[model samples]
Target: MESTQVHTLNLTSVLSVSKKIILTRYWHFVSLSILLFFPLSFSLINISSIIHLFTDDHSNNHKLLITYLLIVYILALCAIGAISYSTHHDFFGEPVKFFDSLKSLTFSFLPITSTAIIAHVIICLISLTFILLVGTILMLVHNLGFVVIDYNSVYFMWFLVIMGVILIAIVLYFYVEWSLAFVVVVVESKWGFAALMRSSYLVKGMRSVSLLVMLYFWGCGVLIVLICSTNMHAIVITTLGSFFFTMFLLRITAANTVLYNYCKALHGELELEVGEGFVHEYMNIPSEN
Candidate 1:
């Protein structure tokens, strides 16, 4: 009987520890939930846009595309900036409410959005260079193959490009995980240039944790997109869903908080040092430690 009681106690403790870990990690779960909501909303909106494009006359449809694209870019830039700020605010354990996020983003997001645009430009340049180089080589290959009566390979080339794009996207997710938080830091600190460097320092030894956090959200995001795409015809019903998403749906705070906590744990185990003023200025609370 005593032995049986001991086993029950052990099982209880194990379950308790597991629950604690999940509760502590609940922030990431919330972030994933927020992320899932947005894409599902956007996918629905985009599908509606596409349905309209198909039904409308060519001129009107073309204008619609342009308008949608412009709105998407602006929204994307602003959203990126907002997320950057909000995520960092979450990082320092500061309360990152939805309205506060909106206000901070509305006021200061342009700078970070501009920074994001610059980064995107640099990415575009690199992509352009790669395309030019690769195109030249492919052209030469095709020209030489033409002598052997084999000039066309459009299908294979497109497939290769598609695969390369997917690969690059995966690599970029891993690369930008830390920098996502950098935007918020920059806005709050008024040290835009140094934000990336500071992010590097913060994430120095937490690459694996960052990668896992990203992968978790990525999986959730893809799943939500897939589910939403199935019933895309309903998107044309109303724009209310998309509006709700942009205004309130997206929340990456919890995942960021989880990552921060993970890093904090690592920081303790590894004895990594934090900046002395980090808690006072960025965190906005007395340091628990």
Candidate 2:
């Protein structure tokens, strides 16, 4: 029943804590990574192959793409669920076990999957809506004779570039807001829209930190993709890329779970505790909020 007070955490602190936790529970995450992330990494590393399949065989491409998406989606959910569960328990000074983390997934998998689907659908809808709105505005301007249709015009190109940047910003905004939805589903037992809402609420004061954390991991992912794509025929490069990608997946999930705890503590929703020896050094255990 003992608890430690949680304090505000920035991007550096969050990543630092995440790294420490992974180092502390190194084997548990490694096993989970091998079980779930290793296979997922193959799909990521061979993404160019899938694109080649698209050009070579249109009919079979659809089947392969669909099957691939399904398998990747399931594997991703499993990785997130197991990592989130283990990280949460470990964050609170509880014992963490790989098998127990896998078993905990039976209860969390459905909820986290539902939340992910809901978040994905919502993001897609938002994107479509933004595109439609932009199109409508462009059409209106065209009709009003404010701007003529000139694809090659520098002004028109700048306008398009501005719109694209705005769209990306909007999408990233929502992404950062709901980045913790799966963690919410796993830790709070909330699902779908409820989890999304909770994540948005929790991430309010910490959006910048979340965004930076996301961008760091995203940049690493992009780097891995570039290495794999450029060295498609190199088995060693692909394998190494997959291993680093798996490590990134584990770290990002752990970072998100740790951020979730910090958010909860910031909002006075949950009390958190680090393990012995590290608690006093890294966290402030206030008597009360």
Candidate 3:
């Protein structure tokens, strides 16, 4: 009976923490946060088009978009890199001035700058492979019409291939989604080896919360796109995609801040160890939250 009571309390605590996070708003930093992600998404979509262009040659002009995409992507990365040291500002759940926090975030990330370079390299390699794989798939679809009865018709191969693609999407989603926490680990925690692992530990039981947060951001992004589309689809797509990516980055940044604070406290780097009753303390808002 005592153990059952403990279990109920634990569940209640998790729910409360999740609710607290959801209720909190960061309207002040929304635009800056969006800036963090916009270029990367455009770069990705542009890469896809570039691959299709090379393989099909049907839309040769789109190569220009790819060039623009890569150039913009590189510039955005450089901008983030420039400000990487300033990402660590937290004033107890209160709104922070963006420039001040940006400065802090950059300094906080200094310890892992080299590691970040390595990670970026790995991602670039994977992106190249991904483009190649996408090109291969497109080539197969165009040359080998064995799976199609009519131009728009599909046979079993089409369904099977579609299923395969959906499965791949699910895998990619989980892979990227989980690692979103790593950047936080990179900056706020000084220790290199333990930073990423610490984030993984903190995020361990919070997968459901993370997924819901991602979904909410995605939906909000959709609404923004709709609003912007009323003016111009191209402009709105660019704006909406950027907004979604920025929010995504900010959430990762915020989640890492919370986790790093908690772990630092646990490791005696900070003054307290915040656990199940973490939020009940006065300093919870000041130091831990």
Candidate 4:
């Protein structure tokens, strides 16, 4: 928890540190992933079944869908909390035990879950507001005869495309800003809006790195979805896909935790000690100037 200096890490360094921690503590993370992520993966893989349950006519299916969703949500929260806690410890060169990580969740789980829910709600609201605002603007323009807002017109199509890009940019901006909220919750015990605000503050001046980190994992997720979609009925393929997806999830969680520390160091809020073990482990990597 103590260090002599803070190192400013680029995206490569952030990922390098994450990789090293996972490699060194491979078994510990695997155990945590198994306890939390394995079931979560199973739940995610059966998402189509859950969707079918929702559309089925039987009241029993409704109950099953609700129950399934609740379980998956809890598992997702636990996975995030556990991985965040373990990664924080490992990154700091502190002792990281699987059971201790779970035990720490007794205090952290609620806060982490609350922060996650709040973040999702805010993102949803932003998307909804954007859609509503665009709809209203289009209506007013049509009503005022500002232009012939023909649905099939090339201009209208271009307008929609432009709006779509802006909306995506807005979402990506907030996503990068709030990317560290879960890590903030686990590490700082700040929850809900507070954690989000703290994340925003920490991520300042580092939005580009945060965005790249987010996009990298997001691309991996998309690739996993593609693999799973193509081989849904192939048990071996599905299982392996789910397993790698879970691993990437863990890696991204760890990367975010490391990024959080890097931000703290950059801002002079923390002095992050690179443990001797970490240094020796990656001694061959050229030093940053």
Task: Give candidate 4's error at residue 42 in angstroms.
Answer: 3.8
Where does model 4 exceed 4 Å of error? 1-8, 43-46, 57-60, 272-289
Model 2 regions lying over 4 Å from their true place? 1-8, 53-55, 58-61, 271-282, 285-289
The TM-score ranking, best first, is 2, 4, 1, 3
Of 2 and 4, the candidate ranking higher by TM-score: 2
> What's the residue-level lDDT of 49 in candidate 4?
57
Candidate models: Cα lDDT each: 0.48, 0.83, 0.46, 0.79
Error of 2 at 3 (Å): 14
lDDT of model 2, residue 262: 80
Under the 3 Å rule for N, CA and C atoms, how many clashes does model 3 have? 15
- What TM-score would every model get versus the actual structure? 0.57, 0.89, 0.48, 0.88
The full ranking of all candidates by lDDT, starting with the best, is 2, 4, 1, 3
lDDT of 1 by residue, 1-289 (tens): 1222222222223223323333544454245334434544575446655657655765455666666666656655555555545555444445466556656655665666555555566567766776777668768876877534233568776757785896587447535544434343444444344544445555655555455545555555455555555655575433444544433333333344334433443345212323422332222212121
Instruction: Give lDDT tens digits, candidate 3, residues 1-289.
Output: 1222222222233233333453354443454545555565444434444466555756566566667665665445433432232333321333445566455545544445544555556556765676677657766986897543343556646855775686556544543343433445445454344544444554454444445454554556556555544444365565555566555555544443343344334334443423333333323333122
Candidate 1 lDDT at 188 equals 44
Report the Cα lDDT for residue 169, model 4: 97
Q: Native-vs-model 2 lDDT?
A: 0.83
Per lDDT, the best of the predicted structures is 2
What are the candidates' C-alpha RMSDs? 9.7, 4.0, 8.6, 3.4
Cα error of candidate 2 at position 105, Å = 1.4
